[model samples]
Target: MRSIYLRITQPVIKLMLALTWSLASLQAAQAGETPIPVEKFFKSAQFKDAQLSPNAELIAFLAADNDNRSMLVIMNSKGDATPTVITRYSNLDVIFFHWVNNERLVYGISEKDLGAGEKNSGSGLFAIDKDGKNSRQLIDRFVKAGAPKFRLLPARTRFISTTGNESSDDIYVGQNSTERMNAGINLFRLNTRTGQTEIVAVPPHSIDFLFDPSGQVRIATASKNGITSVHYKENKNTEWVQLYQFDDTVEDGYSPVFIGTSGQFYVTARNGKDTAALYQYDTKSKSLIPNPLLALNGFDFDGDILFDNQQNKLAGIRYETDAHASVWFDEKDKKIQSQIDALLPNMVNLVDKGRSQDANVRLVKSFSDTHPGNYSLFNVDTSKLTQLGVVNPDIDPAKMAYRDSVRYKARDGLEIPAYITLPKGRPAKNLPLIVMVHGGPFLRGGHWNWTPAVQFLASRGYAVIEPDFRGSTGYGKKLHQAGWKQWGLAMQDDLADAREWAIKQGYADPKRVCIAGASYGGYAVLMGLIKEPDLYRCGISWVGVSDINLLYDVSWSDTAGNAWTKYGMPKLIGDQQKDAEQLQRTSPLQQASRLKNPLILAYGGADVRVPLIHGTKFYDAVKAHNSKVEWIVYPEEAHGWGLLKNNVDFWTRVEKFLDENTAVK
Candidate 1:
């Protein structure tokens, strides 16, 4: 029932001072029912991420400091020792980090101040002790011109994962060769302190690797010419034998999960079913078990297995349905979960245990549709829960909107899953609506949790609906495959269907709907305006693709050279040459003159995926006829806004735009 404040250093005090000024400015800008400022929704969380030491004695986390830079800090889980500032940088921020062992941790850094266009350095890795000693650079941030030769690993080298054995300092790293995009990675066993590495056995053309609980490479998946071959080895002494192969374009076969201590191989497979389920793999027979280990009714197997290192056994399985949940095979852990739930009955409480069974402290992350989430330490011995930190301290669950999972049938009768977030303190009828499309038309969109962008719109009195249209993943094979080659055609229809569904349900005003998204979702925004101008009064698209053909034609884009463009796009999204007619017909660039809705088009100048050209060309075409169009470009940003200042400015503009176009008279 008590809260423990972690000890802070002088730099963190400066960070608090900076946060005060930033928040003061935000408060000065707030007004009306939506008292929460735009900055509150877009600003980085005070506590970015956290992890417990193997023994659960210490906790390491990334915290944003005074300059809005993410710094690495360590604190005692027992709240007894002074928290140590492990890594501090004025310009760069610690982006990714992990505890290598009980005493040492490793992290990767990036330039937070620079946009993707201006960022020239790579994310180099470094290691330091928990006590803020024995600091060493394991990889070079960038290869400086005429720099002296050094022992540090190349900038291209990346830390994959820590060896499960917390007693040792050795970890696994992967380094790609000169032909990085197309070639397999050279696996290495790296020592943190010594900077020495030994080459590990890797399957030919392997793109991914999986290791057992004992830190032995047991499975490798290799991709070549659209075919994915899974290779497996019983031990380090044995050769990797080819298990099975499947076409990358087709949805078939099983994916390797993790090897159990008992040498049982676990995997996830559809097994001739619509949704994927967890099953044990029969190595000898090269097939999945007849019965699934775990399965969900409507959702696919989209989570990881929890292994208890001390007991050398599978403890539980953590998966996602409408929300994240865990199934514990062990009775004691189940009892612990029940207790945590009883204490935090209103939210979803996820319990994470340290590798050492002797560790009494369990890290709990609890959140709900209205809550952004908070991290806490649950002491088993004292039967007490002490709060560590909240993700967004400024967010109030009382003012935030409620997100509900929904489903509606498309024109062809295929059920499309969606999420609808209704504005707080408002009746679920005749509200202004925003059909917010997700970027990855091929990936899953929303989950049953707190989302900043969605909440921000809802706070402004707009009902937001995110449709996991035909091409989106995570639902089942039917929904995913049905989206192939639909792009601006069927995929665009799904957004309109979602809008119609909301209006029919009396949750939206039929005349007050707007469409908005980024990337592919941005593309959908333009297409929605073009194909169904009467349905939407306005449209907002940022860093969106205007021409489908440009996805293949634009060589400067990072997407140009990848496997997705070469193989996946040709099959799933319409081939460049063979389907040129369809591509041109669906392209927003070709039909821009047809769009007459009030529109806002924003693009990141440094975006490599859907470059600024997509926006500039479409603007030129649409602006010639439509005088209501507003165009803005962030030269420093790429793909999406990275800086908090940019995010605040962009969303504030969005708030004004939505009110001007869709607000009730």
Candidate 2:
């Protein structure tokens, strides 16, 4: 490979001119608005994940290596050659890569200096050649005991999707099926250059798959006891067929998304409407077509559907409502997304075009709400954009922090959907707030970019918010079935009605608010300090869930024997022997002696999701009569904090526990 790109092309051009002179001297010492540190808002992102190569004339990304690990380079989408690297390791860390055609690429690795409880679950998979030549490994980073599995493909085989046939190196893997409890995912087709294999059609209790722009597979999806289903097949010698099933905690049917090249399928449902749109299904009358083809208003068709397969149609959809848009339906990819949104007129650009039908290169990406994203390239017959880096080249979008997207009313009139943010040259009034919360209290919390723990609590001056409250999930179906079993009652009163609507819109500081989260937002920060103890003046809760009947008595939680805790946690969280006294009146280790303010409680002694016995049994029952609690733990972290020195030692102990409890006095 030209003497290995002439021996690392002068240390990759002196690491891209010392990362462009260290991002121009850290944006000129963050133009005097200093504060931005706590490990540059939790590290890891020196240019990340960019993609583009299925002949969009090369681009690939992930760069860091000067020992910050990641490393996978490659360039030239007209930025005229030179950038090569192609792979690196010295210990491991190319976490996920793609492009299996347009001169090969596939990737996976991981172990970025251990500590997810001493890592190692399977990152393995390799395969190279973009000029680093025929590299290879193809799966085996750990899975040994009795090592002799002949056709070597173990270490839990993954990488699904990328067979849109760029003249085949074939690539649709998946492996999972450990034989019983919810046994699904087993498809394969391999051969990313002769590690050869070809099973390709399991479909029994499958857990999601949907191929078709000629690479085939045609839909799959599964679920179990609480129902779900949706199977289908029309090629590779047919025979799969189940089609429609539903009731997986009802939002009524559909799902799939993408599989057309004339065999059309596309999905996303909630047909009786309350959100979820995008339609077209009809595999000869299995139904679904009742209008729609992309709906959104209150959100829920969530994203992705692009598909262009050398112009076999449907070239855009993208979605994600409180931000992250894209419509296109192909008018030259909607005039190359309005010429890269009239030259990045305030971020959120996107524009992809990977499996290119060539409207001259594309890629883009961009971002906003205090920028933490970049990746460029655009071109489109010489209009140009170029760049291709910066995902946090020392941040500083004028000292980060804007976010916005509001909406309130939750003490019954429903509405909710939050995300505030503040703090960028302050004065959105009172301030000091935190309210953060999101840890999938049923997923989808805040979106509208640049969030490193909400820009590290708005670069330390605080004011954060977040909300999505009532059972979260891309807003719809009456805000996700209105907090199903209402854990800690009406999801802890929609986070104390988002701290009294951020202190009645004076942007917070009703006595300097506070309430943070992790896992189910650390079980709603110990049920929001035991149901709004004078509306939170303190509480943090990392890797939370202090005993909701130990989520069905923790039989080593991966959510105890899955199928989402036997049929989606008794229909969405609750029911441990029929809500035993409403799960001990909302367990925070059973109310930890009605928690008196000032608390911190972090965890992850190798957290198996909210594990170190949910922060050592709620810091041994709120330090027996709370003496201003503060716990911590981290023994090789998990449920969160995957080492950036434990996210700068747990946000520098949340900046001295919000400066000894809500600073502004």
Candidate 3:
């Protein structure tokens, strides 16, 4: 009986493998052909931004209709019951939400109006009960004759302090921004007995906002450009102090970490030595104590100072190092090596357990180099994880290869981290590689998931390498700050270095390397082919910013504001006027003639960030050079390919381009 069962199962598995290979081959041959419903992917049944309800018994997440109209939905804890929409606004999108009580949820809504670049416009507050009842706007917009009156502060703070225990906690909300932009938030107090709402903290900007462990507001953090102060009415005596004041060179306050019991404030700061160390400001002593846990120079880790307010016995601190997780035993003055081992395995198990419950969790659990992010949740108490969902699960896993994270010392002695995914069922030597750079030149990179593009290329048998080069977030501030003035210089070198590292590691062939990315990543791809033409066989850029100067060259009518200057332009890409030559050297358009590699460019017609002009200008320049370039424009799309048809179409063209141009073994 056992032998017969094995015989039957083995044959079935072998047949399935054969069928998968056949489908892959067919898909490859028809790489340029359109398959599946084009509009189906754009339907926005795609769920995003999920938050567990306050009670932890239900989850309130955002869902969308076929038109991409978003609504708030509530599901049971286990996600067993059908999801019910608490909202039905077709033109409105729920940007974010917070659970008010077990029965009601509050959210910020913004209209889906585009083209004007008004991101914050049409934003207002609303309240809805969990059962899809009593949905009403907390505030509404009105157009009056001749003139209008308005304030940034909300009429109430119901959303911030939702847990019914607001009275016991002292609440404050606006303390971060230096200038109060019309008190941009509303504060409200809800009387539980009569359900009457009263005005609480009037906004423009609170000096600071504080919250307790139960997600309750306890204190407000206040600061001024010239003054360092903590304002709290403690023991009936309201006193303020000039904590540690800095020279005018200092900018911004530390994101305050509150110690619940003593209400002490802790912050991480670099002292005279230019090394980061944790400093605790005692509420009673009014003195600052340097924490020993983070005494190491040139290195920093986020130490969660968990405290059991009831016991006051510092509940131990946990932190992660370069490759290992560590925990600090406060009282013992030593780190718990065993505790780190215990925590990771449990976390892993929780993740593994979650896969069985939610498809999201399961997807994340099965994340590979070729895939994108999968979602899973692990419960600390139960030591179990629930898989919530997975994206693009229809793609067969066997047709893809898993990537391993690798770290290599760059020429500058910087430890660069990257992930290289080999083609499925292919030998390691002489494989074509797509050196993919991540967007956010300032953000983090390549996490586990089912990457349609990566898998699609791997299916055509091209190894893909994604490097989270220097400037990536989640590593530390030092690494991020390093890429400040080195946009096209070091950043471009990092991409090139990845190819060399891969070649040295015996994972890739130097002759058939291609560079690919979208947005900032797209720009990286263009830079790769231009700056290191000999290293790349081809390149792909989708909605990439080509001209650095043109990024800020916009019409007055555009509401994007001076975001480049306001957000990161000063520290990241450099001021346009000051670094004119550097920006010109880095601009892809300036070096378009040097791009010898075959190129594929895709852009959204409505992409205001990079704009259609970016692609058009680059294409025109490439044409002027009489270069071999392929270009495609999606008329209805915005910054990204919202329609699934476009995504599949672009990939199909990409597969054909890579296959025809390069030798993929």
State candidate 2's TM-score.
0.32
Cα lDDT of model 1 by residue, 1-665, tens digit: 11111221111111112122344333433534335788898777778677888888888888878777888998988766666788989878899899888999999999876788888889988889987788889888786766534658877789988887777897899987555355788899989999888999888778898887777888899887678888888888889888889984675878888886556788888889888888878787887777887777667788888887767777888787777778787777888888888787657788887777777888898888888988888888777888887888889876777777778999889999898888766567999999999998788997878998899998888999999999888888889999999998888888899999999999999989999999999999999899989999999898899999888888989877777778889899999889989999999999999999999999999888888889889999999899999899999999899988888988999989988998656
Off by over 4 Å in 1: 1-31, 145-148
> Which one wins on lDDT?
1
Please provide, for model 3 over 1-665, each residue's C-alpha lDDT reduced to its tens digit, 9 standing for 90 to 100.
Answer: 00000011111101122223455545553564333332322233345556554345677677666676677888776646777887867777776776666667667776553422333344555667788777665543332344322323343222455433322222222212323321233445543322345554422334454454444444444333333344332321344333444321234234445545345565555544333455565556655554433443333434455444444444444332222222333432222223222442312111211101222221113233333323544443353545555434444444456655566676797877676777655456778889898887776675443456666666666788888787775445556666777777888888888989988878788888889999888999888888878889899899898977777665421223433343456457777788888889999999888887789999887676778888999998897665578989987677777555677688778878887778744
Ranking, TM-score, top scorer first = 1, 3, 2
For candidate 2, lDDT tens digit of each residue in 1-665?
A: 00000111111111111112345444543465556678887788888888878767878898887778888998878878788887888888888788878889889878777887887677878888899888877778687778645566888887888777778887888888885467788888888777888897666778888888667887788877768788878887868888788775864777887888667787888778787778778887788777776776667777787777776767667776777767775577788788888787657887886776764878888888778888888788887888878977887676676676777888889998787877665457887898888886887878877878888887777788888888887778888889888888887888888888888888787988888888888888888888778888898878888877787777877777777777888878877787788888888787789889888888888777667877777787789798998888878888888778888888888888888877665
Q: How many clashes in each structure?
A: 0, 2, 38
Q: What is the lDDT of every predicted structure here?
A: 0.83, 0.78, 0.58
What lDDT is obtained when candidate 2 is compared to the true structure? 0.78
In candidate 1, which residue pairs clash? Answer: none
Better of 2 and 3 by TM-score: 3
- The C-alpha TM-scores of every prediction are 0.93, 0.32, 0.69
